[model samples]
Target: MAPKGSTFKSCSCRDETGKKLGRKCQRLNRPDGRWSSTHGRWNYQLELPPHADGTRRSPLRRAGYANQTDAEAELNQAKELLNIAANDQALARQIADLITTAVKTTKQLPSPEEVRRKVRTGQHLNITTTLGEYLPQWLQGRKTLRESSRRSYASNLKLYLIPSLGHIRIDRLRVADVDRMFEEIDELNDLITRARETCDPVLRAQVKGRRRVGAATKQRIRATLRSALKKAIREGLTEVNVASLVELPSGKAPKALVWTPERIAQWRTDLDTHIATMSARRKRLWKDTPSQGHGHNLNRIDAYVGAPRPSKVMVWTPALTKQFLERAELHRWYALYYLIAFRGLRRGEACGLRWTDVDLDVGTVTIRWQIIQIGPEIFEGQPKSDAGEATISLDTSTVTVLRTHRAKQNAERLAAGDTWHDTGLVFTDELGRSIRPNEVTDQFERLAMETGLPPIRLHDLRHGAASFLLAAGHDMKTVQETLRLSSIAIAADTYTSLLPQLARQSAEDAAAIILNAEPAR
Candidate 1:
């Protein structure tokens, strides 16, 4: 109910021009006007407090109630809505605005839920802000994300998210809308798969040779959406996070497979046969194929016919790794390769190693910095994790190799004299500049091919190191520490394939410990 001294009045009259003069008749101004039971209507005018600018506000007046009871009911509801004191001008204004909107729209009173949301968020009940507008603002406000992370988030927003979900209002987003976006992505991937399978390799390359977005990419896109929605929720823009309710295709972690003896033999067989067959066919089909002079080269039919698609991460067995090292020993970057293969140093970490971080006398190498490539240019950054920036104990043999490598580098510096760039990197080009990461990968590939070894990616050498340690009976914890992995779980997960054999011995040892207890049989 409203405060004391509130009531409803009625008015009914006609103009001399015979118009139905609603709220405009001169009789409405009378102190004791006669009530018309059949034609007069009830009216209430709420006397509100002054406005925020210290000016009087026009009373919230409404008419057209059929009777005083109806008029009193509306007056009661309005009083309940504006129950705040006069000094709470902000809230008083909100109630005034709410009633004005109700009158204009002629809708029912705002629901309790809607009313609470509006007051809590300090926004109108109806918000028109789009996800597209909020996402950019969210990215700008994220000050702690790394440069690489920010770039990734921006790419997802601009290239994938904004085009799909940007126009939809944040509060209006639905789970079905997000699901439809992913379904479209899946349909496009199907088209990409069909195109790749049907077209010749040369034609596919000419068609830009784009691959379908993978499960991992989709997962990342969802993560970006979830993060943005969380920010919106924090700002009280929306009540629920629809993105959090979405499900995506689970991404599989790439397994690290070692180049065992059987795999090595199989690889050798495939390479020899593939090379001989392709060589013979190329000569015979030279006339049938597209001309090489115009640079519109013909695609190799052999490439499409059962060409090898290498695993993402593959490692060499100890013997093959030793052979590879021996062959690569004659190369200029021998020490770099040795460090990577033996010490499990990442390519970027090895490239980023400075002389100040290496302690040959102490037989320890302190890893601190890494050179990360973004597009063409590379810059120095911290290690992958805090644990990655660690002091790794080196074998005496590795120390000797580093000593010799330092001597060779000094000689090159003396040869260049004033021309040497002096980058202070342990591994560098002849001018003492940091080596490009791609150059290292390409060189490793060429060396592996020349040595007639089974193919494996450069990063696989680090996997091989972990496998070697496990095979030599080192604990997973030790391997984790040596690799500077953040946790033992990661080390174990990465090398789970090598654990069963070691676990069998431990299982037998456990049985032996309890052998004194006789079996029931």
Candidate 2:
């Protein structure tokens, strides 16, 4: 029997009341029976050991291992893992080789604060609480970008980015997780475009085959998001900046639709049928009329009577432009097309015209205000730039068109008499006020649907004008000025469809000039 005071070799039995007993302290005997720690110290049980009577025991296991060495090692590993998990960042990296050597679960586990302290050399991080709040801030600092760029970002976010990423926490966002989330954006864009095919009037709906954000714009948004994190870091809000280490997704260019002349023409014509612009223009005209008049007098007999202002110039694409002219009723629409197409005047410039601005003798139109859209109010503003407000020479055809249109307006003035408003706009309704921009766009669309013309839009007249000029052997610098394109690159990019034939024609012209040159006599 093992001694009670010293370490045991074997158990010494003692029955109840301290009476002498034999084999009672067997290795299998527990305090109650023969299978517990109270037995001599051999713990080799498969599960819970059987009683001394030879009955099999039910199965059970301890939380930890039996051997003291094994238990201590496991306890240490658990402590290390807990410590690492405590970090504000998942950047708490572990080295596989040093697993046994490190003092991790020094007897038990470390607290989150203690673990955090040990790993955070200098960094701090917090998870994104919500996605919507961060995106507008990301867009605010983009002041230097072109209006087109800013508009694109605003549009794309509203349409694509926000709906997907809005709910996720910014800090908790991971590259892998974001990648997974966005994997479907491409598919969704495709589905959206396909679904809208029957419904889309312009067919200008975008489908993202590749990433839309440019490398530079992506950098800007990332910088903005990072700046927010930097503020958090500066304020000691976190121990690590997760955004600092994150690698952004590839900034590949998006696949764009081929803007062919035929396609442009088709879309222009198609839009008129689907969108209700014709009715919109008529509504504006009706609102301007006196209750007594049955319809607007195409020929105002009284030249002194005022006219209702024409609506704002609608955006027209190449396909639908013809419908606007046919429906405008006044010969003025014909002249408007010539000015927009040949003279390259903006909607406001054309609308703001007086009989004085046009010189049939000189075939010139002086440009001044091109119209400005300021909130609910319509106001006159100078053209985009000083150069944009200059006069343009027109050809005889345009002059003839204007002459005819002028005659029609004079007749309308004569007929309206006291009922007409005296606004001096050349393209006015029977009552004289400048037309609303929205009404003009709507008119073009309605005309397009009614006439079944190619789906050319009204603003497309400008494109058509620019395209025509480029095709006529004009230089890009001149075209840029004529179109008032913000830059030369823009003129080339946006109007490429118009210039394909012109490009080949130019080469042929150059070839003819070179080969047919006569030697000096």
Candidate 3:
């Protein structure tokens, strides 16, 4: 039912003296004292509820409705909006303010349904809330997010989304605005690249510590925006998610490449050239400033002269893996390296493994936890994903190695006595404390160097495990389960690059099968 309001005809007809007669125009009323629809426009006026502060507000007056019915229909909508607040005076004032502002600006009434939803859901009643104002609020409300996820969302909001799209009202944000943000990011990347390549130290310093925002990072930023906007939509803030509509390049992981002879030969040549260049640069620096100590110059050169890998991800051949294990046999964490090389345990998983989770009698090890390093702080958390937490079957060789490691650990515990930390982790330092994940990686790197093998990251040992599994005639599904990957597609895409011998055998087998086939008779 429509609220009490005044619906009357009004016109701009003027008297003979040229003074405009608004509602008092004589033509608005007929001789019988009824309103003449043909002579004037319809308008409605209604007094609104008092403000939250108890002060009176001006009535809502709208002009130029076609007839009385149309004017009453709109008036009913406004009343319905006000009725939504019920006995809550504060809510009534908010609805009243919303209607007044809408009519004044857009010359239209606010949608009653939309207003009711916003009020009921405790969403912001104003449509002018900018991304800048709402993104932080949305992030603050996400209390259940993991620490790493929260950090990522906060970084994307602060570093990209807020700076690019924050000022624009969320409802008014468009796809083009989001596209422009990425375009600007690309431009910034180009600038950073140019700065790094320039000889001027000032230009380089300007971009120091600022890495190029890669496609993967940009995709993550987009995901953060999309998630925030989805929450905003649920809160009735915006009707569209502009972030989802923006297309981006695929952020696929680089394929793991086996360190074959050809690539290794090229890498060795590159390393030699790199070392010579660094040697000349070092001499030039010393010649320019003899006062600087020889040790300082050598240290600086050494830092820069470390050999660069031929690819982002490189896996050792089976022979190289064996050689590395042999060299690391005397090392304290040899079992850790052996497990990662054979069982494909992630560095963090190896660091976090406990004796309780290992079952040599059953020839299986359960992955329950992992030690993660966020910045410099180490945390014990669940595995990377649900699939990452599973029981992996171990071979007899691995069981024997683990048994030896346990014996060594017991001896160390007795030697340390009360000084031992007693972390109970299967892989720990001599003092029984859980080893840092980074320390494991650093030791693997040093071991790989000592064995004089092609350089590969500790994580690449996991990749090598996948290759070995494939080479041993295990199917893709078996490899997926053994690796505890979340999906077979991920296992297929990442580890499908076969080793050289496997590829050659596959090709030869295919050709032999075709050549040996009986011809159609």
Q: Pick the candidate with the highest lDDT.
A: 3
Which ranges in model 1 have alpha carbons more than 4 Å from their true place? 1-133, 146-159, 162-169, 176-213, 264-311, 330-332, 415-419, 500-521
Query: Please, what is the whole-model Cα lDDT of each candidate in the order they appear?
Result: 0.75, 0.50, 0.81
Error of 2 at 230 (Å): 13
**Candidate 3 TM-score to native:** 0.65
Instruction: Identify the superior model by TM-score, candidate 2 or candidate 3.
Output: 3
Candidate 1 or 3, higher lDDT? 3
Model 1: lowest-lDDT 10 consecutive positions: 294-303
Candidate 2 versus the native: TM-score?
0.42
**lDDT tens per residue, model 3, 303-421:** 22256766667888787899999999999999999999999998888889999999999999999988876445577877777898899999999999999999999999999999999
lDDT of 2 by residue, 69-167 (tens): 454444444444434534322232222112212323232323345335534644332222455666666567656654434554555565545676667
User: What are the TM-scores, per candidate, against the unseen true structure?
Assistant: 0.64, 0.42, 0.65
User: How many Å off is the CA of 174 in candidate 3?
Assistant: 6.3
Kindly provide the TM-score of model 1 when superposed on the true structure, using C-alpha atoms: 0.64
